[model samples]
Target: MTESSLSISVLLVCRDSAETSLITEVMRKFGISVRHSVETEALELVKYQKFEAAVVDFNVPLASMILDQLHGSASNKTAVTFAILNGKSGRASSLKVRASFVLHRPLSPSLMYRTLQAAYGMILHERRRYFRCPIVVPVTLQKGAESEKTSAHSVNISQNGLAVSTPVPLGPGTSVAAQFKLPQLPPTIAAEAAVRWYRDGKAGLLFLSLDPSLRSELSEWLSRRMEAFLRPVQ
Candidate 1:
């Protein structure tokens, strides 16, 4: 679906019927429509539905199997998957799943809402970048005496640079340093860059000095992030 036409479909799997109701209520408060299901049968149903996202129980029996199936089915479609694990036994298992985010059980409604919004924003940003050229990265600018730190979330990236989301506003011609950790990659790279433009909490940075290896690493991470958006539906 186009980014502008996108709508969120949340699959909420819970063992307790009462908890399912509470989860559904929270989703509605955020204006998100959700599909409530028992853990046992939710996996099969999810395979056939075109949900934009899923929220599942981490401790449910066959949870791994369900996650595996979902992973296989995700194609060219970015669906944010979240696992809710309350008990100690489920912690390790939840970590093993390839979910975008995981939450401990005894769910906090506010936290859940915020997490959902962030995930959705990430997915939306990815989709927009894939379809349009010159993806804008969101970045926060923190000025220092000698240099400025441009903290950015590399939401979308290309060979030129990346789109980043930051915590602070920046202006044109601002020289800054950017630091971010790539998913599944070690050793964060700090680069000298200059802000070409700025908007609210988002800014575009032109890397001043970056080695070939660092650029290649950033390209690989960008590819993986883009691939997540282009994954097909199973």
Candidate 2:
């Protein structure tokens, strides 16, 4: 996807309206959509919705608990989180809460902008892991030396793995070499992949070893496909 199309969803848990306004303004400039929640309803929202990042105000009675729940939630365990503090002393304390970063009281637009800029790359990287692009592509899988290769067609592709359907019986944890060329890409991509799951002639393969260059190429291809497919029906 183009840089302009890049966006992140954030859960804002600040009780202070003025503070939330400042935070949202800065986040909006960076293409981030914030879901603001008051302390009373924050916990329920945290349990269900998935967010790329969360900004919490520590003054609220439930703020620390919200951060704890975010880390404990299976879907949000790796989400980036920020703690809003009223003093510098709270900075050290926020670390114990496992916050990814800390923002001192009296937020400024420039500081917020800079902070988001620094975090954009990491947030995008995390999002890519879960972005799946559906496409059919011929894939060749080999178990080991001297073994015959199996031909398969991929059902979907993600940054770390691909799901494919083949007649060969593949058990979980079976290591195999995978080779395929993405659409519109001239070079073929090859990687060592291990079977993550299999059922009824279909299997999920987690890439074990992919060259950095080829991985980048595949990621770009998937991003472009996803962007085009998800475009609004204008």
Candidate 3:
């Protein structure tokens, strides 16, 4: 549960055996393992087990039922679910298929790969945000035409960014030098960051130019946080 990977269990739902078989095999080639389950029982599986994604045929009547069952359920809440619809039917059901991405049938392999990649990232990003740690750390932000520097405290930290509590919040697009150190990391990490959004005294900074070394360090730190976050509370 702590370590993450591109590898994820997928729920494959479709009426046609050939389409499901082709898609499942293609997913395996991309290093994504999947489990094809009947729609009748898949909802219960989705509710009780962890599935990172689901590929469904939008044309099937059961597809909507699967979506309805898993939409807010814990197992599928953050799972990346996408549908395959006929090109002509894409528009009609665009509003109906509750998927993270919708690809037309007669699917392009390249496009599907890229779509799944994006969906995987989105799923992981949401998971991190949900498990963000509430740890305050020293933060120094430098910004503006005057190169003004300010002291702040990180309110919460995730792999992507940290929300900062500063005396003065900068504009949304202001670029800055962000410096901080987490307990899991040794040296102070500095990165070129930008204010993503600001409200009142808090601003969220997205690290922009993190070097590979620093990114590796940060990734390790985040992995540790993930482990701690997923530990069952006794």
Candidate 4:
């Protein structure tokens, strides 16, 4: 993979200045942007921002708690996580924390680069799911056989759900059948979705029953869109 051509955002939680500098430098080389945070503030940041990956230092007092928060967060649960261990002794504990990768202490640039390369694919896959593409498309929503169909326009779309603006917003917990077409996807994507939230004439629909093939198509479409924006015109 051409690591430098990809765009990835990571949450770096390490209080050690020396280690932080080394990690930051290595990540930059791979075209990944790091948002540095201490263990205390990292928990809150994970709740709000969407990151493809996170690197936490196990030596931090609240490191485990921060990892818990990251995995528990709805927005960040799937984020690829890396645990920085001071020595081999922390390996077993790091496994329990479920970090996607582990970096041992006395981290060298070569070691960091290798680990990042190993996790790069997973990071991109997670990043693709978090990416929201803005496109207005006509969408038909039907709650049930007896209910009237609602016509709405999509505000934005992600791998798991869609945000749509409607004349009347559907209430949360409402189940609906959605049918819409993406730019290059030949067939109309139809899936059963649940209304996750509603506000100000808009509702968020979580796709609960999308077919695997359709999901693959949607993922590919979104990846293309992301690459288009990130890559310069040729």
Of the candidates shown, which would achieve the greatest lDDT relative to the real structure? Answer: 4
Off by over 4 Å in 4: 1-8, 47-50, 71-78, 87-98, 142-151, 208-213, 226-234
Clashes of 3: 0
TM-score of 1: 0.46
Clashing pairs in 3: none
Q: CA lDDT, every prediction?
A: 0.63, 0.82, 0.74, 0.85
**In each prediction, how many residue pairs overlap at the backbone (N, C-alpha, C within less than 3 A)?**
16, 0, 0, 0
TM-score for predicted model 2 compared with the true structure: 0.64
Off by over 4 Å in 1: 1-6, 74-77, 87-90, 123-234
C-alpha root-mean-square deviation, each candidate: 15.0, 5.5, 11.1, 5.0
lDDT of model 1, residue 104: 75
Model 2 pairs whose backbones collide: none
Q: Report the error of model 2 at residue 8, Å.
A: 3.0
lDDT of 3 at 217: 79
The sequence of per-residue lDDT tens digits that candidate 2 reaches over residues 1-234 is 343333467899887888899998887766677889887687887788778889998888988889888889887889988888877777667667668888886788887878887887776666665777777999999999789999999988898999999999999999999999888988998999999999999999999999999888888887786555434223
Order of quality (TM-score):
4, 2, 3, 1
The top-ranked prediction according to TM-score is 4
Report residue 99 deviation for candidate 4 (angstroms): 3.3
Cα RMSD, model 2 = 5.5
Give the per-residue lDDT digits (tens) of candidate 1, residues 1-234. Answer: 253223345777767776677778766655456777766677677676666667777657876666676666654246677887775766777757778898776776787777766776665454434332234433444555565554556555555555567776767777776665554767576666777877867667777867788878876766665545444334
Candidate 4 lDDT, 6-116, residue by residue in tens: 457899988889889999998876667789987778878988878889999988888889888999999899999998997778766766777889888878889998998
